[model samples]
Target chain A: EAGVVQSPRYKIIEKKQPVAFWCNPISGHNTLYWYLQNLGQGPELLIRYENEEAVDDSQLPKDRFSAERLKGVDSTLKIQPAELGDSAVYLCASSLGLSSDYQETQYFGPGTRLLVL
Target chain B: AQSVTQLDSQVPVFEEAPVELRCNYSSSVSVYLFWYVQYPNQGLQLLLKYLSGSTLVESINGFEAEFNKSQTSFHLRKPSVHISDTAEYFCAVSARGGDDKIIFGKGTRLHILP
Candidate 1:
């Protein structure tokens, strides 16, 4: 069984530039998530998708960050006009079920490391 | 809202020595707990979790965690660690019902010495 897949394992961009990260979750997984991890910090959820519906997105920065899970199989997280503080690893995770009472284990991708100059 | 806290930012121990990584959480309602480990330049992996029954949970790789409801803490421990155990450990918590969005703590870097 293949695990979660992400592209552009590493990205370097200047401040004020636009950057996007992509993620393809495991086959048959129904839940997908996007998380951000800064140096020395744990991953924080930016958005979550249950199929094509976004169940939660309160933590996402509306001004500069946007995410979409079209068709609910793959997801894209975008940060336009990036800032120096935005440099971090963008991790994507997936789970088989939507509820913790069910299949709660989350499998993560290699993550896209972003370095904003 | 739920939040997780990992007390130690880094822990260094010699090979074969026992180690413990402390974690605490705050929440008004019931929650599910998890421990994730990440190697250098890698993604996170599930170490263990505490859901409904069994306050004590063990991972296949010799790591274990006990959930303390009174103290609201879940600390990861290994009886004897190896150099391969070196990694970043994160503690996370999520609400029992509603949404399963997890809140993670600042990671703890575990370095196993030779």
Candidate 2:
């Protein structure tokens, strides 16, 4: 089976500009996650969705970051009026919903590398 | 809440030599441990996982990790490594009864020398 897929492998934008990243999870997977990874640091969870319902988003910066999974298959993460600090890699992962497995393995995508100047 | 710590930020080893990457975790409840590998410019892939089994787990590429409950450590070891083994490894943990959130370490970058 194909792994998770992400679009626009890279993006470079000026500060205060809007940027968006897209992701498509593996087939039959019901859980999707968006993570931010800065240089020399591990990826941090920004939001998690279970079949179109956001189950966890405490770590997301609501003032500038927003995410949505309309069909429960593909997701979009957007940053409006992004700041210079927003430059980093945006990773997407998927797994079987928690209701299906006690601990499911997450499959990751190639990630979208964003640069804000 | 759970947290993971990777003691080494980078490790350089000669080809065909053994290597060990250390990982420590803290969690109040029973947890699941995972080791993920990310090659240069690639996505993260599951190297191995420890859920409720024997303390030892091995990956297909000759890498193994032993879960030590008392020490709270899950160090990954490989008796022999190749050039392809060069990558960054991350240790992560998720509490069993928690909100299914996974906490990851800073990651260890392994460099294979000739």
Q: What ranges in model 1 sit over 4 Å off? A: A98-103
Q: List the residue pairs that clash in candidate 1.
A: none
Candidates' interface RMSDs, in order? 2.5, 2.2
Predicted structure 1, TM vs. truth: 0.96
What is the per-residue lDDT of model 2 for residues B1-114, given as tens digits with 9 covering 90 to 100? 888999999999999999999999998889999999999989999999998879999999999999999999999999999999999999999887568588889999999999
Q: Which candidate is the best by TM-score?
A: 2
What is candidate 2's lDDT per residue for A1-117, written digit by digit as tens? 889999999999999999999999999999999999999999899999999999899999999999999988999999999999999999999998855332678899999999999
Best by DockQ: 1
**Candidate 1 per-residue lDDT over residues A25-106, each given as its tens digit:** 9999989989999987889899888887888888999999999988979999999999999999999999986473323999
Instruction: After superposing candidate 2 on the true structure, give the runs of residues whose Cα lies further than 4 Å from its correct spot.
Output: A98-102
> Candidate 2 at residue A35, lDDT?
95
- Evaluated at residue B100, the lDDT of candidate 1 is 52
* Candidate 2 Cα RMSD after full superposition onto the native fold (Å): 1.3
lDDT of 1 at A42: 89
Q: Candidate 1 DockQ score?
A: 0.61
Q: Is the docking of candidate 2 incorrect, acceptable, medium or high quality?
A: medium
